[model samples]
Target: MVGAFHGHAHNRRCQLDWHPMYIDGTGHMEGEGCEHVFSASNKLARSTRHASVFHRHQTIEEHFAFWDTDKYAALSNFLRNHYREALTSIHTLTAELSVYPRLEWELAREADNQALTTIPVGDLNQISAALSQARIRVDSAYAKLQNAEALTAHVEMQLQVEERWAIGDDTYNKYKQETSLCRYCVALDELECLVVMHLFELSKLSLSGTGYKLRQQIGKALQRRSEAIQNALSCYNVQAAALDPPRPSLS
Candidate 1:
């Protein structure tokens, strides 16, 4: 059988580009200068190894499942969703936070602007009341910010988080700086937007009731973001478990 198996393999290899035809073991084989002898049986016995003769293919994908990619992408997208106005918030809040330790002053600036922008004399008292609310919300926002900062620090420290989130950079170093900066910036925006939104809601209650809904959403999204991270981590852990090396059993 082993001899017949090799013979059949040899015949198949020889006839790869030609029509395959064969007769009883006594006949001449097809193609030019190809002749091989073999026993009749086509089965192999368990005593011998057949792999030494047959070649196979290997690729990086064959070794690693790609589930971690979706985990990172989903969380990154969740992170982005949590801070939709990150760019605008960064522009207004970075210096504000550095100098003021919170967004109360930015709200004050907006309050001042509100007085100037209105055609009729607006209630300076309403603006003042919103400023007070803004101060409270700012404190609430930074509390959430601390949680987000800790999560960001943890997510950034994971093994392939930065690598998976090259996020559109041209190199690994770029990946590191860009992901960290953008993530932290977005986190700051998420926090500051919370206060700005509260201020807007309180100050503009008479004008636009729903104008600050996005801020409301960001504030609520703290739970969503935390759940998203846990969900992603769960997926990563499952994939990792599949590839963990076997452990030696106690004797």
Candidate 2:
């Protein structure tokens, strides 16, 4: 290809520029007039890439129908943002923690490690401060995830109950209508507050720590939240037991 272009260059002096172009690990000579050739190659490459055909959709419902149910299993908006934020904090913390090891901290243990590197390495107190901040972010994220999980469980229970009620015989339907003072509804409200509190706490957070101690804070909060969820579940279970027992779940 180079020889052909070089030979062509000798005679065809139509004000063309010559440059080396790499195509699929092979070298080729390109010039001004060779643009058509390059353009053709690009078109061919694009055609190959887009060769597979996909179904077209007429509506959003159609789009959702085409997608599998598992796509809906992603973390919902509330959880997704918090999850990503926590992940970012974790990433930064890991990078911060690894900096010393990555830059040979052991070799310069006695030296002013922070002063030696462009990236600031904190002293013990500063490291503790960064860790406290990381813990706050992590705790907030964990609480949000817990809240989401609880709410999802509540939603599933409500849906299941509705489905069972709707499918039951006329006698069961009459009982369901007559019995509206269920504790499960209150449980749902509690779950809603849990989710809302998670969101509210996130807004209240600043870059610095929440001034709360870090030791087992996430564990303690999760324990308390878990108790709340369990209390709700217990109430819901009572409601379920009162009903003509939920239908056997399909495998």
Candidate 3:
């Protein structure tokens, strides 16, 4: 690509003065012709170097050259702008995860209290039923938190994938091919695997620290209900004994 561009540039410079002469049906002049050829060759060489910059993996150096070459400034600006967008996405994902921990903490505290409740004095069956209901509710909340965390992790992964795509043609083609398994694919596969691992870690952290806290609260609520049921059963057992009719003089 570089060589092609250079040749094109050289051709353009050479043709500049020669074009008019050819159109006018005049032969080339001596001094003026030689100077035009020399200038055109230099311009061509510069253009070739500019085009080659994009193919180089040394982004920093290429970037510097890109800025230096007015002809290629537009391409450089495009890459820089896209990369900025990728950075913005990463920031947004981080902000979203920040709020999850607080919710988890509140849930955990509630669970802890439920786990410590005393049994009530009433219908044992009714108390037991209530406790069971409470347990169900706790489980539901835990499930919901898990799902939310999973969704957040998925979004984070997608953002990372987009970021990788922004880096270069390798990423672009990897995404484009979708199945070729080239070096870029291998790299992306590794990255995706790492992202999944991170997601798992995030889930664990949230569940263990925040979600777990909420679960603790829910567990406490269920425990309190169970105690209430046990008390009711005890009362019923006592009443049954007292209500027993005087046994007909046992033979």
Candidate 4:
């Protein structure tokens, strides 16, 4: 009796794309171009090898898994998340610190203007007391702004540490190879450039304020010069009239 394997073989036949062959005991075949019997078997083996090679090439994740442990990748991922959180917090704190100082400056300017402009007909002691109280309040606000600036500095230092750790030399090189560029370094560089630009703008604003103050001082000097010129011209006119000859009486 034929077994199940024999029945399965009996059912198999050459497909439309395959050539059939019959071989004798002397190893000579008579069929459509079946010159060597082992060639078909060799082709089948080669096809299997090619399939395995293709599958191996396609499984890039598996290839990397064989060489790289997942723990390092996991740690890098965690560090990236933490670094993002820290950076965002630091940015917010920095913005607050920058704005707070400007606010205090505005308040101080307003207080000074009010103190200079307000006129009191009453006792001088009352006016002095009110001005002193206002100055104290402005000083307290300025101190608070200073404290915020210090806190922002501390946060910035912490952010710098984390940024360095996250994108160290080794990590930066590895990221360049893995992702074709160091995204963290790019982001940090962009932020640093922006901060520098902001600093430049702040410097320009300071210079502008100083220029305005200088302009006011120059205007006061010009007013004083105009008054001196008028006084000198009046004195010259009086001296010239006193020295004038009495030519009209002879005519």
Top-lDDT candidate index: 3
Candidate 3: tens digits of C-alpha lDDT, residues 1-251: 11222333455434332333322323122224445445544544423533456554354455446545754657778678767876885676565547457567557545544644544458988789769867886897898799788777777686664443464588665564543334333444544554454454445444544566555654564566455545544444443333323112111
Would you list the C-alpha lDDT of every candidate in the order shown? 0.46, 0.49, 0.51, 0.50
Candidate 1, residue 43: the lDDT equals: 20
For model 2, residues 79-124, the per-residue Cα lDDT tens digits are 7876787787575455344433634433333233332232325698
TM-score comparison, 3 vs 4, better candidate: 3
Residue pairs in candidate 1 whose N, alpha carbon or C atoms collide under 3 angstroms: 1-41
Clashing pairs in 4: none
What lDDT does candidate 2 reach at residue 132? Answer: 71
Give the CA lDDT, 0 to 100, for residue 21 in model 4.
Answer: 22
What is candidate 1's TM-score against the reference? 0.18
Clash pairs, model 2 backbone: none
Model 2 lDDT on a 0 to 1 scale: 0.49
Q: Worst 10-residue stretch by lDDT in candidate 3?
A: 242-251
Model 2 stretches astray by more than 4 angstroms: 1-177, 198-207, 212-219, 244-251
